[model samples]
Target: MIRFGVDRLVADPDLLGGAKRVGLVTNDAARMAADPARLARVALREAGVPITRLFGPEHGLNVQSADGVHVDDGIDTMTGLPIISLYGERYCPSPAVMRDLDVVLFDIPNVGARFYTYTWTLYHMMAACTAALVPIIVLDRPNPLGGDLSLAEGPVLDLAVRSFVGEDAIPIRHQLTNGELATLWQREQFAGVRLDVLSCDGWTRAMQWPDLQLPWVPTSPAMPSFESAQLYPGTCLFEATNLSVGRGTDIPFQQIGAPWLDVPAVLSDLARRVPKGVEFSEVTFVTGLAPYAGELCHGIKITVTSASALRPVALGLLLMAAVASTHRLRFQ
Candidate 1:
């Protein structure tokens, strides 16, 4: 069993360097893999780390808000720490907020995809900390998609298309963990800020999520299963389209659907082009939430048959092409 950064911090509190005022950036989903019950803040505090404030990236601290929804700043009734909303009114903490903290610890996990916003929050925080001369520590975890650098796919961020999701020019499936990302930026960009990465022990570059032997926590409401995450780097692209990426369904991102979908035509088209390590099966369901909520929809369920053989970014493009060829698709 690999000891994650949080577990290490709990075992050895001295790693914090005796910072008087420490800020923790995390959410409910980022709990310790070993304990699961105690969150990083609670665990760190119990271990004698002076965590003074909290920062929430997208989806809010408790993950109460839906994806892409803006969350407001609030206080944690559990910890009584002032929770600053980085996904809303601001993308980074203000200079005043930075002044109140001696160091900031980012403990969020990435979904092995570049489009997720937590990594970008780190990007923003790195800039803020660099300017304020505050040290930032990233508690690293294994990239859920594994660390096989050869498996990385791209359409590396074109500066023109960079948003909160694609903040840098890395691949859509950039095979780097949060700490590694921070390290890269420190070397290439934010060198002035003191950065430390509490890495996952014994985790190798070739190891995927299943190898971690860690419980799969849903970092976002939509991401409920490992299969969903395997499909995320590809299926999430549907979010920008008229089709529902199972957002309102139990199997979010594991399937794709739109009320107008011609299931037979889609199936026929994909029959010849199914990518390796993934299989498509016809599915019809109602998404009780958005897009065509409550309406019966038709589409294909994506299954990751072999994680090692799948290229999600390429798979995403293939899916888009197949669906678009079958129907007149619209982008959102």
Candidate 2:
């Protein structure tokens, strides 16, 4: 089993014992010893270390909901700790939120995709902590896609295109873990945050998450399984179009299409149009939540039989073209 930073922290308290009052920034994915809030807090509490507060990322400390959905403020029902929502109303903690903390800890699992927002949330919170002169610690986990050392696809974001989604010029699937990313951000991306990353032990750059024996938790709504995450770097481009990115389905990003789509034909054309590594399966389903709820929608399931040869953003673009060729698609 891969021992993450949180795992190590629980086993050894001397590392972070120097801090007086600590603040933990996490989400629903934070778990340790069978608890949703995870071991970060429990470890600190067990050591008699003062954990002053809790900060939640996109899905809040209890990970739930679909993409772009916001979480509101409330006490963590499990931990009985005050919680702050960073995904809603604010993207970063105010100086006040960091005022009482000697150190801030971040321990969320991140899929290696650049467009995922947790890394950006790290970027923002680190900046805020920097201004407040608080040191930040990131608990590293494996990049599920297996950190194959390859250059990123898609053009680097033009400064004008920069948003929370496109924070840096890194490629769509920039092959780096949260630890390596934090290092790059401190040494290069962000100017002056005091950053410390606790890296994973027994984890190799080429090992995927399933191979690690750690539990699988969906970091975001659309990204559910290894295959869903595998398809995401490419299929996520569907969001830029009028089609639903499987928002209402049980498996999102895996099956993507709209009621107007000619599902099997599109799959056949997409299979021929893309380079290789991706297999398309025709599927029809209805959304349980979003647009076209209770209505059957035809779409194709994207499967990555081979990660080495698949180009996600390129395939996503081709899929968009296929959808556009048949309908007057607009980004909504």
Candidate 3:
């Protein structure tokens, strides 16, 4: 079982050893166990740790965005604590941001895909903290999808394509816990950072977040549940193409279609091309934001009833091909 750093900190108060002040880089999704009422803040607060500040990544503490939406710095109305937006004007923490904290705790729920910007945010923060001589405490969580050593997917991002979306050459489905990635990164990517990882006790690399008995909160606007995270590494490629990734629907990444798509035909083609753990169903959607907004687009919903039998990245590639061949899908 992987020991979650947050669980470790809770179990052993001596880990902090009466450190008076602390800061946390987190979002609304950073909760303890399956309860939304019990968040990382409450866990730390109950343990008598004073979390002086709160830091939010891309989607803000509330995880509200239409993609590329930047969160602004403000006071958290709920926590009454000052909230800083690291995903604001800059992608990384400024030296000024790291100057006051003794130890900055990181405890964000990640989707386990390399292209997700949060991992890069963590890397850059770790690098900044390393430069400023502040220790980093990572309270780890399970990757929503099991961290099994599956065949990698997505393009190994070339340096030129390195935006916030694709930070490094890590595979699309990296299949590593955030803590493990942090450790590997500390040794090779940012060795100077004073990194301390508290792992999850009940978790294993083979266990996904849904198996961990934790509640699934949308880590970002589009990824609303464990199902979305499972399909995201692949379906997210829709962002590169001129397709509506179901932004307006209750189910975002799970439903993919465009006005130009022939839903039934595409589903049949996809079934013939690559059908395994997932199956496609005809569906129609109107995106509130992005690509085909307000226009009804026909497409298929890729459902993964059984996760262990699914290969998200491979399926994603197949879907990409199917869309490209059938409809003149353009990559942005």
Candidate 4:
């Protein structure tokens, strides 16, 4: 069984070395190995580590908010600790919030895709910690998509298009764990920042989440499964276009469609350019929130048959070309 960084921290509290009050930047997805139900904050508190303040990233601490919606800062009723929102007006914590903290701990789960916002939240947290002169202890988690460098795909973030989504110059499908990413960021960007990474035990670059025998936790509201994470790096590109990436549907990144699309023609075109490791089936859904909310959308469902054989970034580009060729596709 692979032991998570949280488990390691619980076993050895001395890693922080007498740091009493600590601030944690985490969400519900951050969990310890022993109990899947226990979040990082609760687990840390049970283990005698004082979590004085809580920090929420894009979706808030409980992950109840929708994508791209600004989360408001509030007190965690369960813990009575003040919860700061990083996705709101302030992307980073103010000096007042950082002043009382001896150390900052980060343990959010990332989908291994560059477009996802959690890693960027990490980047912001690192910057804040650097400015405050507070040490950051990153409880590193595994990249659900596996960490094979050879599988990494990119258009490598054209710094001009840098947003909250693509903050760094890393490839679209960056095959590195959060700790490895933090280390790389520290080396390339902030050399003076005090950063400590507690790596997962028994995790290798070749092992995906399925190989670890762990339960699938929703990293975000849309990303509910390992399969979703696999398809995300590719399907997420639809967000930049006029197509609906099935955001309001149960299977968000697993399907893509629009009310304006011609299903038969789109399916036929996609079949001709079918990428390896995946199968597409015609699917229709009506979203209640994002994109085409009340209107029915016609699209295809992506079934990832072989994860190892898939090249999501390349496949995404190919998909875009197919859609554009067959329909009046518009980039937003």
Candidate 5:
């Protein structure tokens, strides 16, 4: 069985060493086990862990907020804890917020892409904790995309374009668990911070989500499925352009379209230039929100034939290039 970090921690409370006031950074996606729909906060609380405060990342505590929308601090209805918004006015917790906490624990789910904001949130938390002289414990999770080093891809990051989306110079598909990322950042950037990573049991670099037999929880509003996440390392670049990457739709990131696209031509070009492991079919959509909301978009639906063979970054580039050749594509 694939045991997540949260599972291991709750199973062995001694690992936390009776910390009286603990602060947790988590979201709805951070579940403790396969049943009972218990979040990490609830699991810890039920296990007699004293959780003093809750920290929410980009999508607030519930993971329901829209993309790029700021999440505000509020009380968690179930835990009744003061929830601080890390993606709101500040990307990191203030010293005041960390004052009463013995240790800060991070247990957010990541989609294995470097540009995903959760990893950046982890970075900010590490930096803040270092300044406050508090130790940090990261309850690691699987990368969703298997952790094969050979699959690592990058344009790294050009610090000039660094935003919440892309914070460090890591590959686009970083293929490392969140705990490993915490360790990397500590060694390379925040060396002074004391960090402990509670790793997943029975998980290896070759194990994907399906291999773990875990339920698919939406990491963000747009990332709704395992297939979508598998394609996200590439499709996410569409956010920089005027294209609709199926946001506000049931199948976000699985389809790409814009009203101006010449569907037939785009599909033909994609067939000729795009890599194997994916099949495309022309589709028309009317997005209810994001990018081209209320407008008709004509594009292609991407279906992965083989997850291991898919090179999403390369496919994204080729798809963009193909669409640009047939239509007047614009980047916002």
Candidate 6:
């Protein structure tokens, strides 16, 4: 029942704004809700939008690359267009990539966490567009985690912890769609670029993805499901440490563990400490990937009982604290 920006754009191809050559910053996850088999690019092209090139974000346009894997630039066999990699070799479009395009369109789905690299990709694109004098259009999608500004979490990034994982002073659980974040960046930083947001209709600050009746699509390897994304704003921090946040495993952010972790003790602590919106269970898993592969580790499989009450940043830090306090030796 909800029409995402792609759907609206297709309904009226004029949204391309009379551009003859266009570049799209997108990934495989961006598909039309009405035609799930067709991607946003295909739909736009069918509707007569002249998309000349593409820009791949963190996971590559295919969305199959491993977490933090370097995606190299290549040609999209399906479209026969050059695909520029923003996650590798460069974090933004080179001036040359911008010169070939008359306009740029962005249509990637976001998991609603500041550390989820795609949001920052938009920031870099905004800066590049500003510098190149190319107007950028963002085909907004729903923030799977909901967009209630009041639910935002912080310990907002400062200069010390900034990196590809996070930057600026953006909060951790920033409850906004990617387009909204783009507008904020333009206002605070890249005001020189002309930014247009084709916002999704029927989406509101109070509605989470589950409420929309749309199928969940994985935009990144780790964020494979709603449950994983539910805990990602916090659990992703485990990657910064020696602990395993279940990557290279089936569950990814849904489960967290380290071989050295004492699951029972950590569980006992989290039982009383974690915030109201979540409930977690003890899980013993062997990751097939990194941090601790082939060896068994014990940790928690977090479940969201009430989305409204969860403070992801608070929950994540508390979980870390619990693990750290219980067994200082394994805490990192």
Number of clashes in every candidate structure? 0, 3, 10, 0, 0, 0
Minimal lDDT window, size 10, model 6: 270-279
TM-score of each: 0.96, 0.90, 0.93, 0.96, 0.97, 0.96
Give the alpha carbon lDDT tens digit for every residue of 225-306 in model 1. 7778888998888887888888867898889887788878877887788678888888998977878889998878988888
lDDT of 4: 0.88
Q: Residue 90 deviation, candidate 4, in Å?
A: 0.5
What would the per-residue lDDT of candidate 6 be over residues 64-130, giving only the tens digit for each residue?
A: 9877888999998778888999999999889988986889999999998888889888889998999
* Alpha-carbon shift of residue 159 in model 2 (angstroms): 2.0
Q: How much does each candidate deviate from the true structure in C-alpha RMSD?
A: 1.4, 2.5, 2.1, 1.4, 1.4, 1.3
Error of 1 at 129 (Å): 0.3
Candidate 2 wrong stretches, greater than 4 Å: 32-40, 47-49, 326-332
lDDT-sorted candidate list, best first: 5, 4, 1, 6, 3, 2
Model 4: CA > 4 A from native: 329-332
Query: Which model is ahead, 1 or 3, in terms of lDDT?
Result: 1
For model 5, residues 1-332, the per-residue Cα lDDT tens digits are 77778898888888997789999999999997545277888988988888899999998889999877898999999889999999999998999999888999999999999888999999999999999988899999889998998998868999998999888899999899999999999999999899999998889999888888877988888988999999999898888888899998889899999887788988887777857799988899998977789999987999999988988898889888888877754533
Local error of candidate 6 at residue 279 (angstroms): 1.9
Q: lDDT of all the models against the reference?
A: 0.87, 0.76, 0.79, 0.88, 0.88, 0.86
Q: Flag regions of model 3 displaced more than 4 Å.
A: 1-3, 34-36, 329-332
* Local accuracy of candidate 3 as per-residue lDDT tens digits, 57-175: 98888888556778898887767888888888977777887788888889998988988888988887788788998888888888777767764556666878787877667888888
Of models 3 and 6, which has the larger TM-score? 6
TM-score for predicted model 4 compared with the true structure: 0.96
Candidate 4 residues 232-313, lDDT tens each?
A: 9998988878888888778988888888777777678777886889888888899986678888988888888888999988
| Clash count, candidate 5 | 0
